[model samples]
Target chain A: MARVDRSLVTHLPLFAGVKPDDLEEILREARSARYPKNSAIFEQGADAQSFFLLLHGHVRAAKTTPTGEQIVVRYVAPGETFGLATAIGLAHYPATATAVDDSIVLIWPTAAWPRLAERFPSLAANTLQTVGARLQESHTRILEMSTQQVEQRVAHALLRLAKQSGKKLDQGIEIDFPISRQDIAQMTGTTLHTVSRILSGWESQGLVESGRQRIILREPHRIVVLAERSADSGAA
Target chain B: MARVDRSLVTHLPLFAGVKPDDLEEILREARSARYPKNSAIFEQGADAQSFFLLLHGHVRAAKTTPTGEQIVVRYVAPGETFGLATAIGLAHYPATATAVDDSIVLIWPTAAWPRLAERFPSLAANTLQTVGARLQESHTRILEMSTQQVEQRVAHALLRLAKQSGKKLDQGIEIDFPISRQDIAQMTGTTLHTVSRILSGWESQGLVESGRQRIILREPHRIVVLAERSADSGAA
Candidate 1:
């Protein structure tokens, strides 16, 4: 049995229209689970039996190639819902999700989705909106990958991360999580060596600072300029 | 008053569960409209007032860049839906849709969608499934464009078109539409020169037959082999 956390109800976007009492009712159907750093929650092609709501920490969603190259599609933060395959009527998970750090999540049975959607039209509407936004974002990324250069892609991605999960620090905006150069390379479709070289160049120019495991954007405006240039040239 | 086309209802996947009489009731609100080739049915950034079902001919959904470069994202055929922004609860179309050829389409007012979803939960489910499939396809395309070679991408696109609209002829499986080298180039994210050169190479090898505006797949097996090379290299 999952402990009823009132604050969790307020965080999930799917529960926006759900009254406090109704949320409690829905939460009763969900169980809370915790994962340690680098733990695999689900693997690709596995039966998608449940959906999840992140309560604390971050999760990385990734796809692997036959050659074992991993591409990090996106990271899910606390207050977001994932494993939407059930809502979209998929039988299997399309990608693997792993905990980036110690994380707590609420899991709901797949069977409960339709019943909830029927009882609360707003839930369906919100799910549709979420899917729509994700589709749009994916489309934009496709357009960028098809047309933009790698350096520009890196700059844009950094900006997006800053917008989504940046924390203001004394020197600059720090990405909320520890991300490696390899992770950046995977996200931007570039080599890790290239990402390292670019970051070193930026660091020398006072555009960014590299910590042991994190990156701080010291000059966002300069990175924006680089992104714009890459967007125009269609080269990275 | 809109003329209710009973036969047309059978073509739509959403109407599969609906009785013939129920389909008639649904079609009663539909109005048929004709659009000339190259005519804009709906423009990006315009208020989305209605959704359309293609009854005859084809339409191209495209986005225009700031510099006026147009990129066609999708081509809709008979029995497919367009202007789906309404289904996603969006107020504006994100891309412009134009008639690729003179087309006849059945129009449904945006106001009707909510009532339809309420009255037919199956309809909503079916529509959502279609959207989900499309989103998955888009993601697949993004992955391909990001990682696959241009030749493999073009081959994949051709195979997809053949699957969707091929007509078996005495010579081979003929793509049942007039498509130009430039169009293929755009679809495959390559230059017209590159597409033309590759097609010429394939033509010389008797792999395909290319005429003024038609493409005949003389050896789909060979093309499939080429496409598989990329797929085997680790794209799913």
Candidate 2:
């Protein structure tokens, strides 16, 4: 197990009220594990055994259907927690957590939860806040997917990703992580062919530029308008 | 304020292990309020100042787009909590909470959360569990919306609602509340015209019987099969 920086624990919302000694104790029992790009940190239906705190890199949370279809639920940023199936009493994970890039995570056995929550009440409180916000966001996305057209849904997905992990570039802003059309298709709940067609249309308009899974958003404002334009669409 | 049965507090997942004095204090401060049929209990973008526990009747949580189109997020049931905007630090409510029928709720100011959590850690833990489950369900719905066909999505929505609040009758299982085709359309992210067309087809097939805000599943198993079937459809 690799030791974590003491300062890192002090800054995390989940550890807001955790004392120095308790934090040290937790770090002592925790394991810092690394994963290569495109590998799964945890797979759906696997044993839900641990909770992870991302130390570095991005991960995509996805769920798959019986028909072998997939959808990206959300992406994880550094300092965020993931793989929390046990928090809701699930015996197995309901989704897969795959590393988008080479990543590091601090792992703790599920057994640590009860002691930790009782010792630091803020831990449970912070967890409630995080889960509540994610629930709200998921609900918002459902409404968006239900009411918005494919074009609007794709634009909104890219915009959300850009806001979370965008990097400034000369062309405009890049998504920062290596993601493909298939990944975008999964995120927006459309086929890769459709995403390709939409991206091609946007490329001709100088709105975006893409090559080999790397994309740069040349114009975000126009995309925002496209995301909100709903009159002619047959969506609810 | 209308007083609640003490047994109700004793059985709630959120109140487990709370001391009798603390439970009594919380109940004493809580107000049981009634909402008339079709009236909004809380509207979107309003102040996020209160938390509610549904005591009786149903509610529809929905969000609207800038174009004035709306979609239902989820239906709230009795013995559940809603109006949790402040639970995640949002200053304004992100969605509207309207009574589907006349309803009653136990209302508590948001200020009570911290004190309640401090006195009863289980309160926060239970909140975490509730939020976590809702988050998981929302993620599942997003995946279904992204990867499933309109028929499949609609089927799944009704099945979920029925499972949550269905009442058995001689002909079939009736959804235990009033809900419209427009509401189902909103939940599934389709137009009412499409919903009507599909429901008409199903009615002919004896799969469902719906009219005037009432619906009974004549053949739930067939709908489940339809929901789980995925090929040859415009979905992920």
Report the Cα lDDT for residue B136, model 2. 82
Q: Residue B208: error of model 2 in Å?
A: 2.2
Q: List candidate 1 stretches off by more than 4 Å.
A: A211-213, A230-236, B19-22, B230-236
On the 0 to 100 scale, the lDDT of residue A184 in model 2 is: 92
TM-score of chain A of 2: 0.93
Q: Give candidate 2's TM-score.
A: 0.94
Give TM-score values for chain A, per-prediction.
Answer: 0.93, 0.93
TM-score of each: 0.92, 0.94
What DockQ results for candidate 2? 0.75
**Candidate 1 collision pairs:** A149-A235, A149-A236, A150-A236, A151-A236
Q: Which ten residues in a row have the lowest lDDT in candidate 1 chain A?
A: A227-236
